[model samples]
Target: MTHPDDDDELIQELALAGQGIALVKMEGRVFLRFEGVVDEAGLHVPYALVPAQGVLAKPSKWRKLEREARAALIAERANERARRELDEHVRAFVRELAEECEDAGLAPMDFLHTLADLQTSEPAGAIFDRIRQRLGHAVERQREEQHAERTRQSINLAEYPASFDVARRLPRRFIALLGPTNSGKTHKAMEALAKAASGVYLAPLRLLALENYERLLEVERHGKPLAVSLVTGEERRLAEGATHVASTVEMLDTRTAVDVAVIDEIQMLADRDRGAAWTAAVCGAPARTVYLVGAPEARRAIEALAERLECPLEVHVLKRKGPLAMEPGPVRKVKNLRPGDALIAFSRRDVLMWRDMVAEMGHSVATVYGNLSPEVRRAQAQRFRDGSADIVVGTDAIAMGLNMPIQRIVMTASIKFNGVEEEEIPAALARQIAGRAGRYGIHEEGLVAGYDADTHEVMRSLLKEKPVPLNTSGFAVAPTLEHLHRIAAVTGETALAKLLKRFIHNIDVPDGFFYPRITEDQNERAEWLDTLPLTVAEKFTLSLVPVTTRVASLQSAWEHWAMSLAKKKVTRLRTDDYVLHHMTLQEVEDICRLYSAYAWLGYRLPEYFPDVTLAQDMSREASSRVDSMLQDQNASARRRRPRR
Candidate 1:
């Protein structure tokens, strides 16, 4: 298959075609020349990850697609990683040779750049090697030995506790309330927090933080109301003379000593992206008594943390207050859905679509998903709780946030798209979602099943399976600004991206227990922010902001926020007039999150992003509008339902 016209005949004979590729029959079978090239076989250029639209007549059947193009893409991804490694090597040279450059009369011009300075295919370290050779091998060897010693001492993690003076001063005690879902362990920890004279609750989610914050403010103890502060990336409500505080885990105030601190979701120490927050809270919470509440899977991780921190720990394993049991069979149809039911789907589209089908069957529906704001999810959950909505359809967002009187959970499918491809859901996630059934006071026994026979069997099998135990690696640790600044002082480097790379590669960790983790998103954000004229601290701060870059709108807003901050301008926050006029659910959700990012940035850079209150107000309004739209959709669906 060489010429364009002959390619048609080849595709017709093979019953498969892709963009710009040639194939030849070697044996009985043929393979794709995915790499587009002017090869002898007359292959053209390869299309991207997706094949050409009209070329793929039967995509599922054309499984053999591998020639040079696919291999080239794999090489490109590998090269992308190599590029970062090359950047790191350049950073090491910058750190290890700053003094050598000064001695050789080139320090002034040697503020070495990142890999972005690479103009050709030449390696970034070649110039540094040339400098090293010019400085004489004998002098360079002695200097290298001395520099290695300094780096080892400067980047040691053995003294990590000393970084948190408030925590180091206290004789802390850990109380780990480890158990499965519906075990009431978290409730017990919250009870202790409520009873403390002064305390803080560190929740994993903003919704959970807000819910507990409101509870602390509303509940009176000893005939007097307790003033409480609400702090999270999304919003903040500072109470007057607050004795108690409820904050998202990342907002934990380790500097302020408290009588007690409650850290929810102890098992999240296994999380890749946010686990560092949990580690920081556990190691740095300046409280006399700290409650670590989460699944039993986290018990070992907590034990490792307590041992390393030299804190006393008491372990308590609790039993479920209400037993969970699988249903005998599937519901068979949407009509079989019960009033106190939570139907679980994996995607926002699936959840909304399923909600419509349920509503069209004459059931009142409320929807919750990751894209929806916490306010919206809370309101939808309220509807489900108050019997205003007969059933709730949601993604995994509903699994952990709210406490509903759900008697049964129905799984829509056993498979979900995990950002890449459709794969069978993990047993642990399915169990966590299913465990939402039968609250202690709400229902006697929790029942779980699937919407169909196959799904029901999958659920039944998953319930009996056990979750894997978490590793006892001290915990995932991320760098604080203090650590970064210390690195900068010692290494004479100013680039934030280089500082992070140094943290991962040059840091000396003892016992390999505390593995350093910097998420891919953070590194990517740092690289992009490096293009602007910003301080290392500013770049680091922007990198950590809770911005979901997957959404193009959110990504643009974050970039705009960073650019505005770089220009030293007050980024005014206002609702788009068109958004107010024609607010689609997707648009409102995006705008609501945009306001959240604004509010979050305001707290960090108050002078620049100074619209905290306005952003919060706009966020609430957007959420309320979304809630109203949900009700309107459900009402419309019910009206369209065939009345029996």
Candidate 2:
């Protein structure tokens, strides 16, 4: 139960274990932090044994694999988006031109002469001035789209060199896709997993997981059901004996058995809390083969490890697959809000503010915040895709994965809070975000702009230059013991025994190796059930609880909720997070006057419903008198109901 001691023995053990950590000096002080720790246990510890200045934010090499994979997907989606935008812009122009001809009310010859005479080149001539003004608007629109095309082309060019080594023949197992950004890594991974008899694709982030799950369903070959499932920390979609499971590695764990395992973003092996999942997936996958896909920077190290472990590792480098047209037109500056444009912001509050601001301008707006439920977020994204929502304002949550056709991207701000500190997005992150514009299949081109009037000049310069290549070697950090234990717990003793028999699984984990320690906590189960208050229909919808586990009290509540829905009535019940947060806010506001803003606006901003007054008071009263209130309300409600 004791935490690992912070000492040299542990550091040396981590170093000798080939866990990516090294000794260094910072400001003359010796320091130690994860340099390439890619094992399961090393990744869980947050603070490293190092001087503060030497702390690196980079993830492990395995994570680089994921970045490369995801980067490829971004390229594909970006190209598609660009092509669509190009077609739309051209159509809009033609439509306007046709309307203009109809409104002239003159013969073609007369119209031509009138149009010519409408302006003259002579000095101080009003006729010529008027003619030039009319032509200017048309010229501006043309320039805007042309610039978009150029940006799109630039993105295409960068990806071309990355997808080259791609081959048609599918590998049986041990297919490792290695490439740089925009190389189409994930696309290939998704293809392999979809074609495999049974497989699971693991993503680093929940957003990516959801995106992969949807894509799997979309590309599913029609026949009998694909039996695909999705798993996140809070959500689970299990089908009876389902074969395909696209899940976040943190959610799936290594104890899982499958015919094939597609581990996306293997470079996340450098992550502190989550890298262990990636490490476990790579080192302990039960599948016949594990496709280790990622960027070139991480290839040598990964290949070296595969050799040491005696596992067959085949490396496939996808040369950049597509070509981008040269000298795409100049980027258009978009300081003003447009109906069809996407404004990229960095925070939830900013997304809300922008949504309200743009909505007031008579444009349909949809907000995509990370805190929203997955179902709600997906629905919001769909609204944008179908053009129901003119503007989709969001945090970095919309940065990658999902494809939306957008003509231009407006950067509202450059600063982003990376959990602990506020940092300006480097050119690499900027290029990635800006690349969202002008999807290839969606538009012929795209536009990338920064909001600061000062930065318009800088943006112009950046647009002219190629995006910098991302580093891959920086990702080889060790995994954490916490992850190893979680994997052990999920796999259970029986499955672990089977995996241990496999040579690949046996190669790793130290000698006299004991399984990861796991505490059986029933509180977690109770907490999970309390989190989502489901109706009877929803219970049926998810089919999660076994018949043996169902309780009368819980069943009655679910039945009542279901009946309320049938009657088209709202339930008084609140989401569990809302209830818990509301109480937390009340405690904050109750402390003082100035601190009230922090409570009301900071912590509980989402829970403060405008239509509900005295919400805090009601919450406090309920907490203080839960038994009494429940008894009275339950008795009265039962009396009012007819006898069953």
TM-scores of the candidates in the order shown? 0.78, 0.46
lDDT (0-100) at residue 114 of candidate 1?
24
Q: Least lDDT summed over 10 consecutive residues: which range in candidate 1? A: 45-54
**What tens-digit string does per-residue lDDT give for candidate 1 at 118-229?**
2222223454565566555645554544444555568777676667899999989999998878998988998899989999999999999989988887779778888899
Mark the regions of model 2 whose C-alpha exceeds 4 Å error after superposition. 1-184, 218-222, 293-301, 304-308, 314-340, 454-644
